[model samples]
Structure formats: C-alpha cells, structure tokens
Target chain A: MLRSQFHIELNNMHVELDKMCHLVIEAIDRCVEAFQNHDLELAQEIIRNDKAINDVERSVESKCLSLILKQQPVASDLRDVSTALKVVTDLERIGDQSADIAELILEMDEKDSYLMIEHIPSMARVAIEMVTSALSAFHEHDIQKANEVKKHDREMDQLFEEVKLELVQIVKENKDHVDLAIQFLMIAKYFERIGDHVVNICEWVEFNQTGKVNDTRLI
Target chain B: MENKIVAKNVNLHYGSKHALKNVSLDIKENAITAFIGPSGCGKSTFLKTLNRMNDYVENCKIEGTILLDGEDVYDEKVDTTVLRKKVGMVFQQPNPFPMSIYDNIAYGPRIHGIKNKRELDRIVEESLKAAALYDEVSDRLHTSALGLSGGQQQRLCIARALAVQPDVILLDEPTSALDPISTLKIEELLLDLKDKYTIAIVTHNMQQASRIADYTAFFLVGEMIEYGQTKDIFSIPKDKRTEDYITGRFG
Candidate 1:
C-alpha cells in the first residue's frame, strides 16, 4: 500500500462508523421494545445511552477531518471520507429520533391501550429492519442492498399511513382516547422519520459506491 | 473549447528504453490540462514532447503526430524557434536567469529582437502583471531574480514565459519547490491565465491538479491510463489503476 497510515486511519474510521450504526440500531430496537411493553425504566435507559451515539459521531467527524487534513484523500477515498461525514449526521439523527420515541413512550398514560393498535409496532419492526439493512449495505458496499432498503421505506410509509388511520378511528369513536392517540401518532411518526433517516443512509451508501445521489453526481 | 494541441499515438524512446508509449490527448484552448503520475511514469517526458524539449537528448527517438493549431509540429519546414516562442515553458525549479528581474521578463522579447527600451519596459510590466507578481516586485525590477522568494521566482519565470506572447504555456511541476502560500498563488495565477492562454501542467501534487485543471490525464509506466474531466477523474475514475493511484492505495 502506498499510504499505509492513511489506509489504517480510514479503516479505523470505518470501524467507528460501523460501531455508530450498531449503537443507533440498538437504541431504536430498545426504544421500540420499551414502547411496546410500556417499560419506563428501559425507555429512560435508552435516552441516557443516546449520549454514546453522539460521542461516536464526534469521533468519526474528528477522524474524517484528520484524514482530509493529513492524507488529502482523493477519488474513492475522498468519497468514502465525505460519505462517512454525511452518514454520521443521519446516524446521529436516527439516534436522536429513537430517543425521542423513548421520551414519547415515557409520556404515555398507563391506562391507555394504544399498543393494541398493532400497526405502530409493525412500523417499529420495519424501521429497525430498514436501518439494519441500510447499514449492512453501507458496510458491504452493496448498491443493490441499498436500493432494497429504499424499497423497504415504502412499506414503512404504508404502515405509517395505516397507523395514522387507525389512530384517527380511535379518536373518532371516543374523545377521551384523543390524548393517547396523539401519543401513538407521534410514536408512529418517529418510526417513519427513522425510516427516512435509513433511506438517507442508503443514499450515502450509494454515493460511496457510485459517487451519485438520486441520479445526480455530487463528486 | 477548441483544442490548442492534439497529440496522437505519440511514442518516445531514449536509446533502447521506451519512455512514452503511444500517449494521446487534446489540450483545450484557454484551459488548464494537468498530467499526473508517479515519477518515471513518463508524464514529464510526454510534457517535454509537446514543446520538443527532448530534441536535445542523445539517442532519443520519437514517433507520432503532434499538431499545434492544426500544423504538424515535426514538419521540417516549421521553425522550432517560432514554435518554442508560441509554446513557452517553465521548469520545476524557479530558474530565473541570474540577471535583474526586469531583464528576466524582457529576455524572451529581447531575444526575439524587440530591442526598443520602451517596448521592453511595456512587455516587462504587462507580463509581470499578467503573472500576478507586479504588485510584489514592481518597485524592485532591478533586483536580482534569485533574490526573490521561491514562489515569487516561480511567478517571475512564468512572467518570463508570458512576455513572449505564447498561445500555450507548459509547466512541469511548477510549484513542487514552493511553500503552500506560494503554491496557492501559482495555482490562482494559472486559473486566471487559463482565460487567455492554453495551459498544460505536469504535477506531482494531485490536489493542485484537481484544484486548477479543467481536464486531467493519468499516466502510468509510459501509458496513458485514463483521461477525462478533472471532477470525474478525481471523484470517480474509470480505470481501477487510476483509482488506486489517485486514492493512494497503490501506484
């Protein structure tokens, strides 16, 4: 290798990004579990762990800046570093949105049966799968897999619409359930946003692979 | 943009050793084209061929067609002196003729028989201004060219090249010997000069190539590996060797 130190530093950055992906994925998974079971303790734990994801983002950002300053990477190396810089922002947002869902879970009334709506949990499951698949596409450098993740977002959006309609029906039947329905709506919206973040991550993956986003060349 | 120089199937040999193998490309008019590769990759040899700088080498054999403004550069009827006047060159180091700065810029015009003091003075000032060095050295025109900083010397050399009114300027690693600020000044000067003169540079600095070059060609082991727009060449190179070379994975 011509630039062994640069390759090592780039590899370390990739490992850190992989770590961040897992951290965000775990936060989303646990937040959904906490929401499904109304586990306040787990929800609070997820919120606290969000700091770790943010710290990883900071580490990746610093490493990227160092690579750019020290290595002056070009071609695919430039794309890789720039994509990592962009991917971390989306990953950090995914972490924050997961924490937001955990906070919403904490605000849910104990007597409410919003979990019975069913589609919200399904949305959470699809969101987690989308995030996992998207990061896998990133780590694998698979554009086809990234495209698959994008296709999965459509399923997430569909589930979100179903949840929105179900919540509206519940609120229409009984005005007393309006407060809990709003909470459920917020939770579904968070998952939908997570799906969007996963899609963004996939787009970065495509850029890392092809140097284009949505058919537009960025590099 | 029209092509200022077109080279087709150019091959060169220094005795028995092949230096450049069938290299071909177009140097666009009023644009910067950068040739880049590792040392011994024939990038410099190829650049030298554009101006026939290799004609002095012993046992050197060249075969190819090189056109400057649609005229064959190798035609026996062509005057090399006039060819060189139209195709000026600057070297890697700032080889300012150990004379005063004013004389340095005026040397080319003087050699071409422009002896009128007023005309030489006008050419000196205009070339220095065109090179972005007039403000720094206008008061010190009589100072020794060697006394200037490395970057200033390089710009002075460029000014000397420009004093002759060349249609094309060829720079061989123009900023390799300078500091960052000087290098940036040279880069900015080249960017500005591209509006009037065609520029072909052979650079070891890939960032400099990506920064100022509108078109880039990557050479490897005497072969032209890839050629394209600077943005695509630096972002998503088509050839894997070009990618590996640019990304510093291997060269």
Candidate 2:
C-alpha cells in the first residue's frame, strides 16, 4: 500500500478518536451544568447516563490499540493512537469524577447553602474549557493551541488552591457542613486533576507530531 | 564521554544486498549503547562488525573504519583473534558450551594458559559474582551449564564473557529468547556492568533500549536514521523515521 493511503486511513481514525473525546467532554459539561443548578433530577440522570461516555472511551481505546497492533502506524499515526489512548483514559476518569460530583449533588437538599457555590461551577467551567481547547489543539495538531492549554491550567490550579482555602474556612466555621464541603473540595480537586490530564494529553499530541515531550505544570 | 569503539561512515554488504549504509556511531567507554530497529534492518550486522564477526561470512564486505580505544580494530596488523578477546559477545540464544559451568567460565582463560587452579577459581567466582550469579551456582559449579534455567544460563554466558576480562561486550538480542523475568535479570546485570565495560546491544525492544541505554541508534532499511541520547531519542527524535520506528510504527 502507498504511504499516502496509510496516512489517510490514520487521519480518518484520528478524527474518530477526536469525536470520542468530544463525547466525553460533552457528557462532563452536561453534569457540570446540572450540578450548578442544584437540579437533583438532572444530576441523577447524568449519573445514570455515564455509561455512554464510558462506552466511547472503551471503543476509542480498542480502535487505537488495534490500529497500533495491526497497521503499525507511522510517525503521526503512532502518536495519534498513543495520545488517544492516554486522552481517553484521562477523559474516562473525568467522566467518573463528574459522576462523583453528581452523586454529591444528589445527597444535598435544596435548602443547603454551599460555602463557595460561586467558585465551584466557575472552576468547573475553566477545567472543562481546558480539556475542550486541548482537544481542539490535538484535533488541529496546533502546538500554539496546546501551549495555550498549558497556560490556562495555571488558572485551574489557582482556583483549586482558593477553593481549598475557602473549604477549610467553611469547615472551621461550621463543622456541620464539613462533610459537604470536603466532598465539594474533592470534586473541585478532581476537576483540577482532569485539567492536568488534559494538559498531559496535549503534551502527548505535541510529542506525537514533533517528537518533543514538553514539560508542563503538574497541577 | 569518549567512545571506546567509534564507527565512522560505516557501510556493509551481504553479497549484492546493502546491510548498513553510512552508519556513524560512537559507543562511549563504560556506557551501554543500544541499537534498535525492525527485523533485517542491520542492527545485528552492525553489532557483528565491532569484533569483525562478519569475517566468517562469505561475500560479506565492509567499508569504513571501526576504532577500538582510539586504535583501528580493522587494521591489517591487528589480529582478529586478539580483537575478539578484547571485545566479547553474547548471542540471542544462550549457546553455553557442552561442558560444565566451570569449563564454560574457564574455557577462554584456559586457552590463554592460566593453569593455576586457585587463580581460575578466583576468576570463576569473581566473573560469576560480576554477572550477579555466584551465590546461586557457586556450589553447583561442576554441573553442566545447560542444566540451569534459561535466565541462569544466559547469566552464565555473561560470566563466561566477564571471565575473559574484555574491554567491550556486544549483546545481540541477548534477552530476546528469555522470559520476562529473565529479561529483567539480564537488563539489571547490564546496568550494573555499564560502569566497568563498554556495552553495545542490538535489540528490537524499544523499551529495553530506553530503559538501559545511554545512547540509542535507530536503523532503518540499512541506514542510520538517527542516533542520540536515549532521552532525546525517545522524547524528541529529530528524524521522522526514528519517531516512526520508536513509537511502534513499523518493524
């Protein structure tokens, strides 16, 4: 087979993997919106519907692994599949983490006032945007965009630290809210980790395309 | 670090076929350099050239020079036997001699006329210990080397090479035939030996190359595609062919 044909096939598979990333991100986005509005019904529904995102992660992983094992994909193709594998693993964990937050949302009653309600959803949005843009960079093979993702991760890290501080203050003020605040803090931390993972995936995309692995912030 | 054996503009041919084309590599003293590529890519052929093992093959001709410790190994005055003694080799399969472990370790030393039993015993013990296997087989040195496990046999072969006290050791897919545990043992042993012996290994396993080698040379279609530090080669290979091969594109 011609090299161009092999490359075209790998490009097609890359698009499919990108679509899978989109699916999981959209799922997490939905859960984020649900948790923000204290919509227990919607949060519960998102928790119940997480299987679809999980399924995409599995399918994409299988596709990438098969391409690697069978086609012996060349430079860019190998990078794409390897990045897809790591990204899907990260996205899958994000899906579960979002579900965890949704479960917390389900337990809280409608009347309870969150310690840092304003910060949590906004933090989630930033985290989601980080993943979204990182995936966009990967899909376009844009190193500049990946670098932007790295920059925005700083915001997520700062927000995580702020939230941690606020939760600590709330726990000290009212021990009754300690459990809820701790759970919320864990959710925020998971989102922060998700952001970090997205940055990692972006680094892989750069490494795949340029053969360079960039060192990014851990948080 | 300066290379003990340096190959400059090296090329090789097997009959009408080119096996290596313009491959220039520097293997540092007391460092492990791994050559990785797909099958039939001339990694083994290149490894064989270091000690002129290809001299045994008919119609196999080489161009360019290989230097050993700043001296030309391929020089007409340099005895191939003497060169082989300075550069020891271990093959893919552990072809232990059809003799006991004692004889296997003693074979080369004995050929060189080291007849003192006490000295031979010390060499055997030290070589086996250097290969990290003295304690397991010190009591059973009289047993046939083949009777040991595959990993132990491979280590015994390493001990045999160490007994010769070579300056450089070439491993041609030495762990390819062994189990995972055996592969790990050999890898660990190589790591330990790197501080004392200049080691060159040809392997198809990229992870192995990354794990143990200080320098990695990627070969493709009888050409040196890229050669660099292992971290740089794995993380950011300059050549597209290198990136393709290391990331598991083609064999």
Candidate 3:
C-alpha cells in the first residue's frame, strides 16, 4: 500500500477517536456543572445520560480492533491506535465517576449545603478544565500540553485538600450540618479524582505520539 | 555455530524499486535465524537472496557480496545451481512432487548423480528421520506424495530438501498452512535440526520467531531495522519500529 493511504487511514482513525474523547469530556463537564448548581433535575438528567458515553467508548474500541485486524498497522500508527483505545477507557471511567457524583448530588435534598466552601466550585471547574484540555492535547498530539496537564493535577489535589479541610471544620462547628458537609467533600474528591484520571489519559496520548511513558507523579 | 553465510552492505532491487537497503547479516552454521516483519517488507526477499533464488526472477538485481564459507556465492564463477544445492529452501506452501514419497526424497540424490539403490534407501531413511517423519511414513514410502495430510506433506518437502544434503536450509513461512500441533512439530524440528544444519526462516508470527529463533532480525520497509538475540529483540528491541511491531502496537 502507498504511504499516503496509510497516513490517511490513520488520520481518519485519530479524528474519530478525538470526537469520542470530546463527547466523554462533555458528559463529565455537564455532570460536574449540574452538581455544582444544586440542580437535582439537571443532575438526574446527567446521570441518565451515560449511555451516550458508553456508546462512544464501544465504537472507539471496536474501531481500534478492526484497524488492528484489518490494516495490520505498523510502527507509530499501531501505537497511536492502541493508546487511543486505552485513553478512551480512562475517559469512560471518568464519565462514570461524573455520573456517580451527579447521582449523589440528586440524592442530597439540601440546596444550601454547597455554599460552605468557596473552593469546591473552583475545584469542579478546574477538574473539568483539566479533562477538556488533556483531551485537546491528545487530539493535537501536543506533548507540552500533556505535561502541563500532569502538572495541573497537583493544583487539583491542593484544591481537594483545602476543600476537605474546610468541610471538616464546618462539620465540627455544627454537628447538625455534618452529613451535608461530608457529601460535598465527597463530591469534591470525585472531581479531583477525575482530574487525575484525565492526566493519565494525557500520559497515554504522549506515549502514543512518542513511545515514552512520561514519569509524572499523580500528586 | 560459525558464520556460514555473511551478507555485508547488500542491496537488492526489483526494476526501479529498492527491496533491500544495505542489509548486512550473518547466517551462523548450526543455528536458526528468523527474519520477522510485515508483508512486503522484504523478509522473504532477503531470505531468497541467501541461496540466490532471486536469479529466477527477471529484472531482480543485487549489489555487494554474499559470502558462503568465505567464498563469494554471487561471484561469476560460482554456479547458482550448485549454490542452491548447498542452500535448500522450504516454501510457505508445501510443494511436494507428484511422484511417490520415496522418489521425492531420492530425487535430489539422483540429480546429484547417486544411482545406487542401497545409497538411495539410506538417504531416504536418513532424510525422513532428520525431518522427524521417518517412523510415521517409513511404511508408506511407496505412497504418492499428494496423498499425505498438509502437515505430513510439508514434512515430506522438508525431507526432500534434507535429502539434497544442503549445508544451509531456508524456510519461508514453512508451517503457515499447518495446524497448531503441526506448527509445534515443525518448530521442534527446526530447533533439533539447527545442531546439524544452518537454518534461516522468515515468519510473520512474532511468537513463533520468539519461540524458535536464536538470532532475530526485524525488517521494516525493506530495511533491516534491528538484529540481535531473539530475547532482546522481543522483550526490548533497540529500535522503536521493532518494538512497536513486535508488541502488537502495529504490524
């Protein structure tokens, strides 16, 4: 086969993979947004909307399998597709975690419980932003952005720590609000974890682009 | 095993297309060497060069020297017919002769001017035994070669090659048409035969190459990208292309 044909096939695969990653990131963003707004209806909608992400995951995985069995791609094209499949798996898990957080938010009846911490909303925002940027970096094959996202995971960890400490103080000050504070803390922890997972996805992308798994600490 | 065939800065071309680019490798005597790569990467073409099988194809040309026992096999005075007798080949498909099994094994010795009946019988027995098919087919030596099963047919072809008393054997995907048991038998035979004859095989199966090869050479787009011990090439190939290919990251 011609080299041009090979490149075209690989480029097409990468494009479709990027689109799937975008859908997963969008789902995660919506779930986090719904929880932060204390909108039970929106949170429930996000929780029920998980099937789209699942569909995308299955499609991307099968595409990678077909590429392997049919094209018998070699060298970098093989690494790229294999890593894309793994990264989508991480994205799927992130989507699941987002849905889980959304379900928890819908179960919590208290609306003002989220106002305890100024950092919790920022934490969610930063986490989603990290996820979105990491995926973008993967689509662009930007190693610098991948490394930057890994470094940003530390900020998400700091936000998680600060929010957890603040929530503990709030629970101690008023034992009546302990349950609500704990629930919000748990939500913050999930978002922080989502950030870490996205960073992992970025690391896989970097490895696909350049066959070296970056040694970045998760923090 | 000593180096029996050495290719230094060898380049091959088919008309305008370059098939091998400065490929340099040593085929050791009494050892099995595997050539592994995706199709159209010149692994099979490179294997054919060892015995000058490419001479049959028009417009195929080779540069540099291929030395067999310190003598240039491609020299003007070196007859390709005699070189082929020294380096026998087994192809992907079992191409057994239409004659009887005994005749198939005896054909090579007869072509080389061995006419004694006692010598022919000995050569057939020894060759079949060398291919690990002597006991299975010793009673059926008079049977037609085409009547055997696929695996048995492949073994028969191997025995036919062995009967020629070639110093080097070239197998190009020899077990590709056989079942798992047959593949294992051929692989085992290759391992055992390496102690007596120098062997070079080209295979698409990485697992098979890792399993049976002592030295492995990885090719990509007509270039010999990596050559080393089989374990090192499989576990940690020095080249990124080789690692990617072997690890199922690509073809």
Candidate 4:
C-alpha cells in the first residue's frame, strides 16, 4: 500500500512494455536482414524468435492486469496503463508479421534474379525505422517523432506499389519466375503492414497523452 | 440530463466549519448518480443536502437552492414531512427495524395513513418485489427482519425505502458492509431500481460507483473536484486531485 511501491510497480509495467517493444524491433531488423542477405540461418532464427515475442507480449499484458488490480490507477495513470495494453497488441502483430516475412523467406527457393528484390529491402528499411521511431516516440512522449512516423508511412505504401508494379512486369514478361516475384510482393506487403502497426502505436501514444482515442471524429 | 433534483451553488456549514462548499450538479431522472470521495470530503454531506438530511445536525446552516421538480425544497412553506416522504433514504448499516419483515415494510405506508389491511398487504408485496427481496423472504413475512442475513437486511432497508413510493432515493454506503456477492446483488438492485427512481448514492467503493452509476461526482476537502459521466470520470478524470484520489495516489 505504500505510494512509493505502487509507483515502483507502475514503473515496472513501463519497463516491461519497453522490453516488448525492443523485442519486436529486433525481430523486424533481423527478419529484413536475413531476407536481404539470403541468410536462411538468420531467417530461421527470426522464425524461432517469434515465440519469444509472444511471451513478452503476454508478460506485459499480465503486468498490466496486476497493476490494475493492485493499484486501481486512474486519470493519466490509468491512461498510461491502458495505452500500454493496446501498444502490446500492435507490437505482437508486428512481431508476427516479421516472422511471417521470415517464414516466406525460408520457403522461397534461391534465385539469381528476382523482381523488386532491391525495392523490397528499401521497404523493409523504412518499416524498421517506422517501428523504431514510434517506440522511441512512445517512450519519450515525443509527438513530433510520432507524427513523423505517420508521414513516413506514405513512403512505405508507395514502395509497396512499386514492388507490385515490378511484379506485374515480371509476370507479363518472364512467367517462369512469376511465383518468386509474387513472394517478393508478399514480403513488401508485410513490410507495409509493419508500417501500419507502427502508425497504430503512434495513435495509441496520442491516446495516452490526451485521453482521446482517434477511433472517432467529432466534426 | 432530464434531472429530477438540482443543487445550485449549494453551501453547508457545521457551526463555523464549512462542510460543503458551493457544490452544484444535477441528479438525472431514472438514473443513478454516485458521489465518491474520502472521509470528511463532503460527499456524504452533499448527499444529505439533497434530501435535507443535514437539517438534523445542530448549528447546521445551508445557503443555496435545492430544487426538486422545479420547486425549492428548502422553501419556508415546503413541508419537511412531505419532503422526507418524497425522498427516502437507506443507511450504511443494515438497520432493519427490530420487527417482522411485513411490519418493517408496512410501517412506512401506515405512517402515511394507508391502513387498509389488503392495501397494506399489496404495498408490502410490491415494495418487496421492487427491492428484489420478495422471493427470498415472502415465506417468512412474519419473521423478525433482524433474523435475516446481512445482505437481506440491506435489501429490506431498500424495500422499506420503496414502501414510501418515493420519487428519489438517497443511499449512504448501502453496500459497504456486505460481501462481494451481496455487494454485487445490491449493485444489480440499484441498476434495476434506477429505471423507476432517481438515485443518489455516496460510496467509498470506486468500482461500485463505476458499475452502477450513470454519472459520478468526486468530492475532496469539501469541494466538488470532478463531475462527469462515470466512464469519463473513471477513464479520464480531468483534475489532478481527482486523478490522485481515484488512482490511489492521494493520501
């Protein structure tokens, strides 16, 4: 019942949430690196690390529940706890998408040439930055950085379109490798999805800061 | 808000001690409004002002308008008896009268002069049903109310309040003394009763307020710190002091 200890528990919740964020960030970085370098060993590592991401997300959620039951937080304190609750959901999905990308990378046969292989890496880099920047914004309460994540999302979307266009060109011209080009498109789609999850984390940060969720509009 | 009772800039004093300070809010009709705060923060004092329950305190002076149905309840011409009849109250302790259940419920209508045997019997049944106590105690109508469980006794108190057919009910910590299941039943009973009567309850149980109340007001140091829909109050309290109190940060 000590105020200091209640706050300590609250701080512990934040630390756990940050830990989950870092885990997902690592998954994104390594998943893309394994894909770019054609490193099947690293791809398998990311796929295995998916279970760890789920465990951290589950642990953060348990911590949130404990804080609510023990401390009964309200106002901004309550907001922070609930926001952390939501943040982990998107983080878990980002983790899953990374693993999905890695799984696809695992199944794809080695190819000397693939459509948009260079472009997909660019998308992955932007997506990784999005996740990394959004987590930093949330940890530091930086609205400007969160906004920048939203702005950068457009680039991720455009790169996805470019990959799709190049896939279509490959399918039209050299139908022999069309299936591998389709896998590249799927990877680009996963990277775009990772960007979307980062945007969601930014929106959750806005909710934590102002207690206003962007799920509705008042106009 | 379709308010049933309105307090406007209400102030109360216990001799020189300012007990309630410039409090104002509406108790919406057919909805439960909960007043929550720590001890001596004026939540209970303000709840009493709604039904003029504070009039019993010696040297208590009230200086504001409380209107029920657009009529100033504190007007010189307003009869306190009729006022009390229109606004019944349930207390913290399950203070069932040391009498049979039938008599405990019939006592209110008898004092109001409904002496016909069948009429009083019907009123007893109706009030008991309204309080969700009829099924449990109908067979033991003649048994002493003090013999019932603590939860039943509290519901009997609610039945006694309902017996008067009051338009508004003021409860002071009605479930603070009961177990979790009993507390849940009381909360369910309150939610059901709010459809027929406007309710204002003062409670220290934060979850109880959130569960049943449509609106909530947070009191602190004789001041109304925050007032809003229960969802807003719990999820996003505006004042730092209100936040502290709810978040268990305020001592």
- Whose TM-score is greatest here? 1
lDDT of 3 by residue, B5-88 (tens): 999998999999999999999988898899999899999999998888999889999998899999998899998878989999
TM-score for candidate 4 (chain B): 0.99
What are the per-residue Cα lDDT tens digits for candidate 4 across A1-219?
338887888888878887888889899989878877778899899989999989988888998999889877776777888888999999999999999998998888766333345577689789888998899999988777788888989999998898888788878888897778777878888889988888989988788877765744111
Q: Between 1 and 4, whose TM-score is larger?
A: 1
Better of 1 and 3 by lDDT: 1
Model 2 lDDT, residue B14, Cα: 92
lDDT for each residue of candidate 3 in A5-60, tens digit (9 for 90 to 100): 55566677667777777777777777766765778787777777677777778877
lDDT of all the models against the reference? Answer: 0.92, 0.83, 0.84, 0.88
- Sorted on lDDT, best first, the list reads 1, 4, 3, 2
Query: What's chain A's TM-score in each predicted model?
Result: 0.96, 0.86, 0.88, 0.92
Error of 2 at B165 (Å): 1.0
Predicted candidate 1 versus true structure: per-residue lDDT over B38-82, tens digit per residue: 999999999988888999999999999999999999888988899
Worst 10 residues of 4 chain B by lDDT: B242-251
Native-vs-model 1 lDDT? 0.92
Best by DockQ: 1
Candidate 4 CAPRI assessment class: acceptable
Model 1: per-residue lDDT, tens digit, A1-219?
788899999999998988998899899889878877788999999999999999999999999999999998888899999999999999999999999988987888656554678798789889889988888898999999999889998999999999989988988999988888888888888889999998998999889978999889988
